[model samples]
Structures are given as structure tokens and as C-alpha cells.
Target: MKLLCWNIRGFGFTGRRRQLIEYLRQEEIDIVGLQETIHQDFSMHELQGLSRHQFAWQWLPSTGQSGGIFLGVREDVFSVEDMDRGEFFLSMSVTDRRVHFSWEVIFVYGPADHARSAGFLAEPKNKVERCTTPVVVAGDFNLISWASDKSSPNVDRVRMRLFNDCIADLALRHEGLGANLGADLRARKGALLDQIKVLDDLDDGQGLCPDGWLRRYALESSLMDIYKSEELFWQRRGGQNWLLKGDANTAYFQAIANGRRRKCAIPFLWDGDVLLESLEDISTHIYSFYKELFSAEPRGGVSLCADFWPLADQVSDAENADLTLPVFPEERMTAPWLRNSVKRLVRYFQLGASAATPLLQCSDRAGRPP
Candidate 1:
């Protein structure tokens, strides 16, 4: 079955709507999931205009002008057994008309707000765990699976880890265009190299013949295509943009990606003085450590004051006294990092908590960092 998942940006524009309908008809899309529709409602005629073939659809209204989700299935192809919606997602249980096979589909539009992202990511787990049928979850997660998934240098390692962990907990397979292209390039390279080798042996020690030379030229052209594909794949993996370079520098790009992988890897974990080298051991150690660390329940009447945060960085007593002392109206004091309330200080502690915690929990439960 064919499925199209897209962020339409908004479905309000007439031209865009017409173009989308035309494309849907041309492509014979069986299932559609659209995000950021902006509009809260659609008329029957308007819904019908999405495609000539009748469709069963479910949609969530945009919260203000910001976010929305729409899911549809061609009525002739599938029967909708059930449908549901949450603040961030639309889910449907569908049965195939031909095979009578059933599955669950969840189309999501993750929150754009970082503060709400944790709850958004956590929301699907309960639904997924309850499902007896196979599930396909797709949409714009507004997250990257890895730090290198985006071109921007400002990386949020914590968010990336949490997003990846959520995917893992859902038991979802993450695939991408670059991965498919990379696999195809490897297969093509193998075949091309074999053919080139055959041509080389055939032309061995012979005065260069036009037929052999032509065949070699064709092989060279194919090699160039492979190089271009490899370059594209590695460029994405390395998170680098290309300039007008005459040559495809696949090696350079691959090196950059490899360097990133190395920097992100933890070869071993220290458990007290002993190092955990085995995968199973490391996994157990981390799981046990964090499980114990956060297992503490809050006792009644327990609260924290500023100094109670022993591991948190502090303003010295002198600095505190200076701030508390009366100041002339003309005098001004500015602490740039501390300007934005305690948010930056709190975030700093969060990132640097490793100073106290020392070992980090692997990004994946399998004791491997991706």
C-alpha cells in the first residue's frame, strides 16, 4: 500500500489545495497524512475535492494558527474500523478490503514547543502498548535522530537522545532516503567494479582498442555516478553543505562523518574503579544506576532552597552580599548569563550534571551510543 506523509504547511490556499488534489490523483495515493493544515474545519465539498476517489479522513484542528494533523484513506482500498485523536496525533485502526488484514496507523504532529516536547513524545507509548495489531507511526516529529541529522551547528544532545529513546521504546524502525541511496550505491559499486575488472582483464597488454576503450569509458562514467551518489550520502551524514567543487569529495565527507561518530561514542563505562567493557554488563550497569538514582520518592515537607543544590554552581557569598546591598539609582549591574532568571543557570547544571554523575546512560538501551 502507498502512503504519503507531508507537512502541507497549511491547507488553506486554493492553489495549493488544487495542486495537492492533482498530485494525489496522479500518484494514486492510498493513504495520506498531512500536518499543519491551519484550518480548523473543512466543508464536505472541500474534503471531496481532495481526491476524486472517496476517502475516510480524521483531522485535528490547528491550535491557534500553529499546528494541525489530517489523516485520510481511500475508501475503496481500506475500511476504517476505529478512529481517535489526541492533542498531538490522529490514530486509526484500518482493515484491508482485499485481504481483511488489519493494522493501526498513527499520524503525529509533535509539539513545536520544546517545553511540551517531553509530554508529546511520551503520549504515544500507552496507545502503542495497548495495540494488538501492527502499527505504523509517521509524521513530522520536529526532531532529529542524530546530531548530524541537521545542518545547524547548534545541537541539542539531550533532546536528540530523548527523541531516539522514545522511538526505541515504541519499537519503531527508522529509515531514510539517504540510507536507501547508500545501500543502492554499495550494490551498484559491486556490480560496476566486477564489470570493470572483466574489461581490464580482456584488454590486458593489448594496444588500446576503440571498443575496449569505449567500454572502459562507459565504466568510468558509471564510476562517476557512484562517486556522486556516495558524495551525496556522506554529505548528509556529515551534515555539511556543498560548494561548487569540481570533484565529488566522498572521502572528505565520509571522514567528517566518521569523526562525528567517534566523538559521540563511549567505548567503555566506569563503574566505580572497575570498567564495564562488555555490552551486556554496561547496559545492566547503566540501567541499574539510573533506576536507583531516580527511584527516590519525595518525602513530605521536603523542599529545596538555593544552597540545597549542592552540585549546582553558586554565586559566592560576596557576590550575593554585593547584590543585596543598596545601590545608587544611577549604578547598574549586569550578569549576562544570569540575566534570564535562573533558566540559563538551570540549563547549565542540566548539561554539566555529568560532572557529578560521571558516567552517562547510553543513548540506546542496548548500551550503544548512536
Candidate 2:
């Protein structure tokens, strides 16, 4: 069975609506989940227009202009058993007649507001825990799985934490395009359409020569490498000790690395005010406050000891001398065990250093301190 998910942003524009209908008809998609329809109500005419291929749909309308969720299923292919709709999601239980297989699908449109989004994300986990059927949760989460999911240097640590925690706690498997391409194409649906066309053509074996195929393969391989490298870079920046190793380039690991970065961030500071947002300002404020705090003189205090005494009463000169003697000989440091331990530590350090050297160089090239 084929499933297509897209955040169409809105269906208000006639051109976009036509494009969507055309795409749906051309692809002959069996199931689709759409987000940000931006319409509070769908008229009969609108429903007829959207259900071009006899697909039935359920929608959770937007609150004013902000949020909407939609799910559509081809009537000839599957039968919908139950549906539940909310402000942020539209879920349905469906069975495909072709295979007699049934599953639950949760189509989500997470709110732009972080708090609401957190609650919306958690609902699926709860649903999965309670339901016996296999569930496929899909939508525009408005949350990235890694720090490198976007090109921005700064990341929303709190929101990312909540997002990643939800995914991990539920053990959900995330499958999609590479992070770089996803971020790049996020705002350009036209480019995304072109990519889809290319893939379709390639699947039909109707486009590109052996050389072109080789180039495409090389390009994909390079993109995958870069994606994995970026993930590793962020992992290292977040002070993670574990290596990604092998083909661990899935969204689960990316979410994990993003969560680690969030935790590693300085969320807030205890500067008189409970939380300070500016890192540099907070650093300066904390440094000055602590410096003065440590430098301040103490007030009057009572002394616990009455007087001082010599150590002669506690030990003889020979005993004192013996106690002061060094515990090991100078040559003892050269023992095989000690030498081996030190060598092992050095080797480990070198391995880690080598692994991190590329990240350091990249940071330097970007004119950022490592």
C-alpha cells in the first residue's frame, strides 16, 4: 500500500488546489495525510473537488488561520472503521481489502506554540500504548530531529527536547529524506515536486543513462555521507561519547543527538532573575557576582582551637621521616603495567582527537571558536 504525507500549507489558492488534485490523480495515492489546510469548514463542492479519485477524507479544521489536520483514504482500496479528530490531529483505524491488513494512522498537525505542540505529540504515545494495532504516525511535526536539521546556528533546546523525548519514549521509527535536503526543500514545494518527478521517472527506468545513473548514485552517496557527518558533528559538539557506528543514520539517532544537544545547552542562569536568555550577558553577570561573593570578607567569628602545638608529641623523628618518604621509587613509574595503562590512555585520547579533528576544522573555517 502507498501512503503520501504532505504539509500543503493551505488549500486557499486555486493554483495550489489544482496542483494538489493533479498530483493526487497522477500518483494514484492510496492514503494521504495533509496539514495546515487553514480552513475551518469544507463545503460540499470543496470536498468533491478534493476527492478526485473517490477518496473520502476527515478533517480537523484550523483554529482561525493556524492549525489543521487532514486524512484521506481511497474508498476502493480501504475501509475506515473508526475516526477520532482533535485540534491538532486526525486519527483513523483502517483495513485494506487487498491484503485484509488493519492498522491505525494518526495524522498530526502540531501547533506552532511549543506547549501545545508538546501535548499534541504526547497524545500519539498514549494512543500507541493503549491500542493493539500497529500505528503509523505521520505529519508536519514542526520539529526537527537534530541540531543540523536546519541551517541555523541556534536551536530551540526545550522544544527539541520534548519532540525527541516523545519519539524515543514511544520507540517510533522515523523514515524520510535526508536532513539537508529536507531542510533545503522545506520552503520550496516546487523543487520538492521536481524531486518527486525525478524519483518516479527513475523508478520506471525511463530516464538517465548509465553515466547519469552513476552521477546520481555518487550524489546520493555524498549526500548520505554529509548527512551522517553532520549528525556526528552535532553529537560531538553535544559532548556525546558514543560513536554513531555503521548505518546508524536513522531519525532515531538524529533525535537522540538533538536531545543530547538540548541537554548540553545552558537553558537558563541563576542571575538574580530566575532565567537569563543572553549567554554572554549571563556569563558576565555570573562571573562578576561570584567573584565578589568569593572575595568578600567574613564577619566576626569564634575560633574553635585555643592554641597551636608541635608534632613532637605525636611521633618520633624517625617515624615522621618514614611517614614523609615517597611511596614509590622513580623507576616504579616505568613498570610494564603502569606503562601499558598510560599508553592505552594516550591511544584512546589520540583516537578521540582524530575523530573530532574534522569538526574542529569545520568550526574554524566557519570563523567560530571550537
Candidate 3:
């Protein structure tokens, strides 16, 4: 079961989308966990109609009402169970028929400016410390990992200690089987806020390879007819990936980190080579890790200041927020606000949330004509 966890950044692109289709077509990945989906309604269409993969998806909302996560699994191999906690998180269970074993998968959108961020690393470390099951955790953690995985030529001082402590604290079982493309992965070096850990499994015996090419060795199921896909690529953002596309180059990525630039509606990864998978766009890596056993949770609706939120119409300037609004889909603040609202409301219905949470009162972060 090959799973791809990624922070796709955004789903707007044409060229980058093509490149993504090309890769996934070759990768045929299974579970994809995402975060910062930045969409109002977390629709299942991205997965349900994704190429030939039959799947289910769920979107979780954040306390500030601006972001969340979604997960997708190939329908043929797994079964899905929606865990609707639209208020703070999104989750689902995927089961394989051969082994009735099932796991819960959670998509998280970390609070950028919250007190919880200060105290929760150890909390999860302690929480997962006793865990003994398949758990795949991936996302743009915002926290920095030692800059390299086991396959790295050498571990950095800061990165090494952080990972070691996590292992000791989480009592995590093992790193997933890998080509250990650590050094190869950061060939250009300079990566922040992304990592994947698998419990109950150690390196699949293959040590690190010189390049991250080990992905080539994995079995791929996503390959739908290449010819047909090339013809159907409806990708709109052609120059976003910067990696594969000429315009969205790494220079811009560096600028963002160096503080040489400010946030743009531009996404981190936007290219045809990188399909703007809403779930994958937000979450990345080890998606199947917690499908069944590991468990840690959000504080709940009690922590949210629901009153601070603007009415859908008032949302246009809502703290100045809005979702799926054409005005600024590229802007992080606006899109996430509306995306999660829609996701929260939709999920509220899907999970059979109390009828009191009336969807009618809800407005797309940017209030529109009723």
C-alpha cells in the first residue's frame, strides 16, 4: 500500500497539474493525507473522480475558521468511514479486506499563532509514546525536523536532536521502509516543515540511495491511460510548481523563507507535475500510519471564539475572510476561512451534526447575495 503525503499548497494550476498527473500516473499511490486544504467545501470529487481511483474524502475545520485537512484512498483496495469532527479536525477509517484491521487517519492544520503550539509537542510525544500500531503522521508541521531523514549523508545538530527526542518521547516504533533518500531529497538542501514517520515498521531493509529515486522502486497503481490523461488535464495553473515549471522556480521558495518576500496568493507547489490534489495539497506523507490505532485529539469547540467570526456576507471583509471567492483564492487568509466553513458545514451534515447548526445561516466567507 504505497501512500503519498504532501502539502500540495494549492489546486490551481495547468502545467504543474500535468506534471503531477504524470507522476501519480506513474506512482499509483494509495492513501493521501493533506492539510491547509484552503477550500470552503471539502468535496469528495477530487478523489472520487480522480483519474480511475475510486475514493472518499472528508474536510476538517479549524478554530479560527480558515484551514483544515482531507484524506483520500483508492476505492478498490480500501473502505472509508467518515469521522466528522468538522469543528477542529477531519478523519476517516480505511480498511483492507485481507486484514479486517482498520485505522483512523487525521488531517491537521496547526494553529500558527496559538498557545497550544507552545505546549503540544511533548503532549503528542507522550501520547504516541505508548502507541504500538501502524501510524503514519505527515503535514507541514511548521516545526522544523533535523533537515534530513536516516538516508541523509549527515544529520544536522538541531535536526538530529529534535528527531531523537521525538522518538524517545513518542516511543515511536520505526521509520517506514524507504530508499532513505534523505540527502538526495534535499539535494539542493534547504527544506522546512515537512516529515513522515511510520510506527510498527522499520526501513524496508533498503538503506538510503544517493538520489530520492527510490520512489521509482515502489509499485504504482495510479497510472490511468497516459494518453487520455494528457488530453483531459484541465489544470489551470500552468506555471505554479516552480520545480517543474519555469516561472514557479525555487528562487521564490527561498525568498519566502529568507523573509526576502511576503506571502502572495502564490502557492508553494504549483505545477502540472504536481497534481493540485486538495488533500495532498494540504497534507503529506505516511497517511496510513494512524488509520487504525494511534490517537490524540483537539481541545474541542470550547476553545473557539465563534462570536469573533463574521456573517458570510460580512466575511468578505471578515477579519476580512472568504472561501472559493474568485477575488483572492490565492491568498491564504481568505481562502482557508471560507474553505473550512464550507467543509465544516458539509461535514456537519455528513456526520449528522445537530440540526441546530443550520447551513442556511452560513455564508461563503465572502458574503454574497442571498
Candidate 4:
């Protein structure tokens, strides 16, 4: 009954497709929902290759480059009864033959545009209501159910209300709602403080009941605990550096990360003497720069450094022969540890190249090698 959901953005690229396959294999997932595939068509061969012929999938192609979704069910585990596809979602009715159980699964990719998001939120209400089996709705809804769901300063109250209303209307449980209850609890505490103030102003010379004050104290304590737990959660997600010194505001941390990313981006780049702003121009400039940089020879002179530290004991002939033995293709592709290591290396290189690109461009513009 293990299910995995991811917004893969695009699965067309070879590296991403390989990574997805590796992840699926490693997690041993029974069912998977992938969003933002961006591919207009996928072949049976490609699907088999991606899933290693273990899972069967149904896909809704993207309209242009904007939206797409896919649902993959483990062929050995579930028998798919029917599939319904939409612009923003895909639903499948499946039965587990072993357990003799049935359920309806929906994978949704909500639109980013506000108006489209609203429509996406409302579109599935009827389908949800009509479903008789246990329904599992999942995917990148893109709309947060509460104000504090986003770390940015710009909290869309209207969108929050729409998202919450949609969930309530559909009678769906929001698993992450506990994280957003901090605000309501804090408001309640504030009202309690105001009531205490009014009680004090009465000057009855009789103190407030211990039970009422204890409840207020307990609420304040719970709020503080919630903040600490949230801070720890973000820290575990590798966001400690972006966290405020004393503040545990998740939204503020997100805003800081977003600001840093914006600041790091190359908005404009100099191509020879021309300043390029368009994405195409910028991409061309980067391509040309990297091509020349990698292809160019040493400017001053080439020098081969001699090995300074040599092994004290030379390898035996048997060891050298073993090293020279050819590696099999199956060994290269099927070895779990080797595949995982290569994937990690690929991810590292990709991230490093992106972060260093702007710095390298700046250095080249200043007539220096980077």
C-alpha cells in the first residue's frame, strides 16, 4: 500500500528519467503519481524502460508546455479497472486482487495561475462526491490550505480560504493542517490575555480562578512548543542557515531563501560587448562561453606534474590483471550502489555548474579566467 507522489517538473531529460527510475526502484513503491511530465507523448518502450516492466502507467499529456500528470500502478499488485484523465488531473479505479479491495486514486496538478487554480480547486468536487470506493486524492495541488503554509510574506488569504473550503466541501482530511494551527492558537491566547486585563480592571480584590489561568498558560506553552518543533523540522530539511537567529517563523525563512535565489540569478549577461537579457540570448552566451572555456588550451604553457607520492609496495600481477578485466554492461546498469553513486555525482555536478555559471560569466566579463 506504499504510494509516492512527486512534482518531477519534466521527465523528458535522460538524467531526470534515470533518476526517477532509480528512486522508484530504491523506494520499492507500489503506486506513484508524477506531475509536470511536460511530454506530449511517451512510448510503450520508454514506459517499460522507466519502470523496469514492473509497473503499468497512464498519462495525461501537457497542453503545450504547461501541465501534465501520470499514475503508475504496480502490475503485480493491482488490477486497474478504469482510468479518467483531465487537463489538471487523472483518476484511476483499481482493485487489489489479493486483498479483494477496491479504491479510486486521483492525481492532480493544479494550475499556477490564480484563476486557473480556482477552477482546478472546484473542478473535482463532483467526481469526489460520486466516488463510492475509498478515494485517495494526491498530487501538487499548488494551493496551500492555510495562511502559514507558505514562508513568503505575501500570504494570499483569498486562495487559502478557497483551498480550505474545497477540502471541507470534499470532506477530505488535510494531513498537514496541524502545522497551520499555530496562528489560531495564538489568537486565542491573545483574547485570553485581553479577558485577563478586563478582569484586573474590575479591582474586585479577588484573583481569577486557577483553572482559567492554567488553561491560558497551557495554551501559551503549547504555542511555544509548536514553534520549536517547526524550527526543528526546517532544520532537518537543511534550512538552518536560512533560519532567523531567535525567530522560528517558517515563512520568513522561505522568503530569505527565495530572496537569495533571486539575487544569485543572472538577470542579464554581457555577450562580448552586447548586454543580453532574453533567455535565448543568455543561454546562447553561456553555451558559447562553456564551449570555448572547455575547448581552449593552456594560455601560458602546459606542464605535467610528476607524481610526488608513489606507492611503497607495487601491486601484484594478479591484482593488476583483475583491474584490467572488462566490466559487463549489466553490472554497470544493475548495480544498486554504483547507480546511486553516479546519480548523486550527476546531481552534484548539475547544482555546482548552475551556481558557478553566474560567477564564471562575471569573471570572464572582467577579463579573467574562472
Candidate 5:
């Protein structure tokens, strides 16, 4: 699953939100953790509009004017089992429906204020300590861990040490830039291309040497292998169906995915005479429609016909006892069906040891049903 953790700074700007939404769509992020949203009050519709993705969301509204944290998981990908919100964090326990893997995800916007920083850092540690499942803690930490993280020498070493300690306590590792699968795939593809270029240069120098040609063939094979891996990576990202033998690159799949998303979106719905354009209106209409459609209908009591009892067959106590009797191994071997077993057992009981001799002999032999 692709997760995006971004401090979008202020999600209040219309243009910035539009660009972020476009980026989310392009990246095909399965879960997103957004920080520093300045809005104190907002709805899921507003979030869906801002991100342009259909997802189940939970958020911690901004305190005064500065620190909102939002976490959204694509509903198709995850089933939210539980949700919680803190002063500086929003958390959710989710299960990946396809694979049935469960995890806890926390989106934090750590306090920049010295007074609140300790509590913000400790909150996640406490939350993670109790979790039995895998955990993902992400978002704007607002704490610098090293001198290189800041531009100047004004780094807070105390806060950095505490943040590092909290991470250690939770057993969480940092995933820096180019740490994800897509980045690794791209890096591998680049390395293979570089190797191929080196082989091409050697071929130019050697002219028609057999050794140079052999090296070129080996490099070309490696390049093809990397190309296949890269193609598969993009195909998964684009969520497109695999195409038959052809060199359909990343751009082709991406374009198809974009088009598919557009086609699948429900912008508006007609509620009889009224057109529901807003998300709330459309959703409410759908909910109400289904509720009414499936609502219980009033009906009279069901009655059986007087003649039905006379037509139905009834078994006597003797017949029922025979039907319910447990079949012995000798009888089961002689006859596979329950009816045959009942008749055979009855006959064996009537004829005593002489009639059961053959069945006992068969059981003593191969023990297969004869």
C-alpha cells in the first residue's frame, strides 16, 4: 500500500488544495497523512473535495489557528476497525480487506511549542506500546533529529534526543526520501541503464571482438530483466489490467488509470426532480433511498392448508428407529447405502450368527467394501 505523509502547511488555499488533489490522484496513494491544516471545522465532504479521492477519514481539528492532522484510507483498500483522536494526532486501526492484514496508523502534527512538545511525543509511544498489530506513525514531526536536518546551528538537541528515544521505544524506523518501493525500482532501472551504457562504450572500443559482444549480450539481458520489473511496478501503481506482448510504458498505464478514475466518479445524482450536486446531498439521498427500499413490508400471518397434513408422509416409531440406527463396519462393508444397511442388519438379526458369517469373514480379510 502506498502511503503519503505530507505537511501541506495550510490546506485552506483553494489552488494549493487543487494541486495536492491532482498529485494524490497521480501518485495513487492508498492512505494519506496530511498535517498543518488551518481549518478548525470541516466535514468529510470537504476533505473528499480537497483530496479528490474517495476515502474513509478521521481528523483532529486545528487548535485555534495552527495544527490540524488528517488521516484518510481508501475505503476500497482498508476497513477501519477503530478510530481515535488526540490533541496532536489522529489514529486508526485498519485491516487491508484484500490480504486481511491489520495495522494501526497514526498521523501526528507534533507541537512546536516547548510546553506541549513532551506530551505530543509521548502520546504515540503510549498508544503504540499497547498495540499488538503493526503500526505506522507518520506526519510532520516538527522536531529535528540531527544538525543536518536544520539549516542553522539553532537545533534543539534536547527535543531531538527525546524524539529519537520515543521512536526507539516504539521500535519504529525512519523511511527517508527514496526509501519506498517505487523509488527502489526506479533506482534499479537507472543502474541497469548505466551498466548497459558502459557495455555499449566497450563495444565501440573493441569493434568486432567476441568478448565485447558477449558482454553486450549479457548487459542487454540484464536491461530487459530490469525493464520488466519497472513495467510491473508501474502497472501495479496504475492499477491497470496487463496488456498482451508489447512495450506499453508507464505513461500508457497512467493515462488509462486517470481515465478510469474519471469514468468511475459520481459528480452528481438526480433525486427525482432535484439534482444533488454536493457530496452530502448525494450521499444522503442514496442512504435514504436504500433504507426505504429495504424497509419491512406489512404482511398477514402465514397459514397451512387443512388438507396439507393428510397429504404429507409420516414415519412410524419402528421405521424411524431403524433409520436412525448406527451401522456396524460389517454391514457398511456389505452395503454402502443407509437403506441397504438397515435391511441387512435386520436380516442378520433375524438369521443370527449363520447369516452374519460371510460379512464377518469379509471384514477379517482386506476390509474393503465388497
Candidate 6:
């Protein structure tokens, strides 16, 4: 079970969304979580169209509703607790009666606004202590990991302090897998802005992030950074989707974003100055990209895991490469990896893009730097 996450700005850029979809294809992900979903009711329902797994979104209105929350579940997982309370946290669960194995999943789009990050992040930390079931929380914490304090602009002390408080207060385990901790100037080619947080340390606390044996997974991305704007894409307001794997639920539903008229967030695509004519085109673009990537079977005969991981090359060494061809998988498959990926892409375009536009970003957000 693999979870992928990222915060792609606005969720509207359908053009670059295929990269996210293909990422899922490449990583063979299970559950996917997204943040900053900007859309209204009808516009927010884009998740249903995607193939493979069932999806749920919690699109709180930005105008009157707070924006955030999205969860996509694989078909085999058996989803339960799908709710759209117009809150920052959205929930889902999967259980195996026979094995007595169960898991509860949460995709939280915590507020980046300094004022909002506190209460939301704390409550969860406190609850995990007593919950009988194993809970995996993924998505942007909006706060730097305590390990992120190594260099550069110091993480906000108040926020950092609050996060540390949670660590002690809740005694929550760190199960993050530390996928985004690798962001650095070298990784960004001399720039100090790689959006993902690639941390070297795993949670020494409980067991939040994966470490040691889970090193290769530190690079998979569920979110796509279409706009190269360093500020927008990296630490500030870029687009991203946070995924929570483990025992995820079956397909349920949540609206990514629902706003009123005019102020509604829009994903505008343009040719220099000419605005894109249709959002429908964005969907087509994703489908085409997917076809190109997965049109054929896996190459260089290898085990499915081997095809995904260089570490797994042992499984494909010697004669195995000449044996069975590994499966890279499609997002439309009944399995967790496929359904989770495909659904995220579908909702991304619908909620992110306009009814008739392309290019992805919050063009309506005033003072948005070009």
C-alpha cells in the first residue's frame, strides 16, 4: 500500500495534470490526497468521471466555505466514513473482517493561513492517542517537520512550537515515509526551492514516516507542480495532492471545492494572451497522455515491483528479465494503485479548470505574482 501527496495550486491546470496521472502510473500508488481544491458544487464533481477507483472530495467554499479536503480510494479497499462536513478533515476507512485487520485513512488539507493551522492540526494529534484503530494521516501539515529546522529560513517558531507540542502532547508516531524531505538547492539546480519535503530522518516518535527499508519511496509524488513559479510552487501557494496509503477505504465521494459565483476559483489556460477555449480539452489531454504512457505492457521482463524500484532489480536479475514482463498498471484498474491515481486526475481538472478554459492557476486571486 502506497500513498502519494502534493499541493498543486488551484487544482485547475488540466494541461500539466497528466504528469500527476502518469506519476501515479509510474509509482503504482494506492490512496491520493489533494489540497487547495478550488471549485464550486457542480464544478467540484469531477472525480466521478475517472476510471478505476471510487473517490470522495470535501470542497469547502472559499467565498463562504473554507477550501480544502480530498480523498480517493481504490476499488478493492471498501470505503466507509465518506463525509463532506465543510471542514478541513475528511475521513475514510477499509476493514478486513477475516484477518481482523482494519485501517482508517484521513486526507487533511490543513490551512496555510497562519491563523487556521493550529486548532485543526492539534485535534487530530490528540485523538490518535486513544483511537483503537491504526490511523494514517497524510497531506500537507503546513508546518515544517521538526527535522526541517536544519537550515535556511527558519520554520515559523510559533508553528514549529505548536507542532512540537503535538509531538509531545499526542505522542503520535511518525509514519510519513518522508517523501518530500529531499527538497533543496542542489535538487533544484542551485535554487532553494524544491516543493517536496525530502527529510533524512523518519519519525523517531511513534512511526509516522517510512524510513530505513522505505528509501526509494521518498521520491514518488501524488501532486503536480505545473507552474514553475518558485514561490507559488514551493513553500507558498502552489498546487499539491497529499496521499494516504496503508489500508484505505473503497470509493466514496467528497466535493473538492464549492464556491459562489464570480469569486469562484478558476484554472485559466492561455496561448500567450488568448485564453484557452475549453476545459474539456484538458480532460482529453490527460487521457491522451495516459494512453501514451501505458499503451503497451511493461518492458524488459521484470517483476512488477522490480519495474517500479531499482532496489527490486534483484527480482528481475539474470533470467527474470527474459521471463514474465512486469505490469506497470493503469489508473483504471480495480486495484488500489490504479483507482486512487485516476480519480485524483479526474477531480483535479474538473474542479481546477473552468467550464471552458485551460492552463491551471488561480487567475482570480488578486496580486497573484506572474
Off by over 4 Å in 2: 178-370
For model 2, the local distance difference test gives 0.68
lDDT of 6 at 184: 28
Tens-place lDDT per residue, model 6, 1-370, is 5676767555556854566676566776667776665644424345553334554444444433445555666655444543333356665666522222366776666675779778877666655654567676767666766646448765677778787677667655455543333342233332212312323233343434444324223232212122233345345321333233222342311223222433563466554565655777656665677898988875675423323324332222332222222334342244765564455456445443332122232243432211
In model 1, the runs with Cα more than 4 Å from the true position are 178-370
Q: Ten consecutive residues with minimal summed lDDT in candidate 5?
A: 306-315
Model 4: lDDT to the true structure: 0.71
Give lDDT tens digits, candidate 3, residues 187-268.
2122111111221122444544533223322211122222233333323222334446453447755665566445433334
Sort by lDDT, top down from the best: 1, 5, 4, 2, 6, 3
Per-residue error (Å), model 5, residue 178: 4.7
Best candidate (score: lDDT): 1
TM-score of model 3 (CA atoms): 0.37
Full-model lDDT for every candidate: 0.76, 0.68, 0.47, 0.71, 0.72, 0.50
2 versus 6: better TM-score goes to = 2
> Which candidate should be chosen as best, given TM-score against the real structure?
1
TM-scores for every predicted model: 0.49, 0.47, 0.37, 0.48, 0.48, 0.41
Residues 1-370, candidate 1: write the lDDT tens digits. Answer: 6799989988998877877888789999999999999979978988887888999988999988989899999889899999988888899999866434588999998888888889988777677887899788889989888877889899888999998898788876676654455766786688768877877887775555887677677767767878987997887764544453223667766675788999987789998899989989988998998998989786778445434445335444443333334433343344542464255345446545534223222233332212
Please list all clashing residue pairs in model 2, or write none if there are none: none
Q: Please write out the lDDT profile of model 2 over residues 62-149, one tens digit for every residue.
A: 8887777778888798888888776567888887653345788888877777657767776767777776777888888888878989
Off by over 4 Å in 3: 14-24, 44-47, 61-67, 81-90, 107-109, 112-116, 119-133, 147-167, 173-370
Of candidates 3 and 2, the better by lDDT: 2
RMSD per candidate (Å) reads: 30.3, 29.1, 37.0, 30.5, 28.6, 37.9
Model 5 residue 278 lDDT score: 98
Candidate 5 has which clashing residue pairs, if any? none
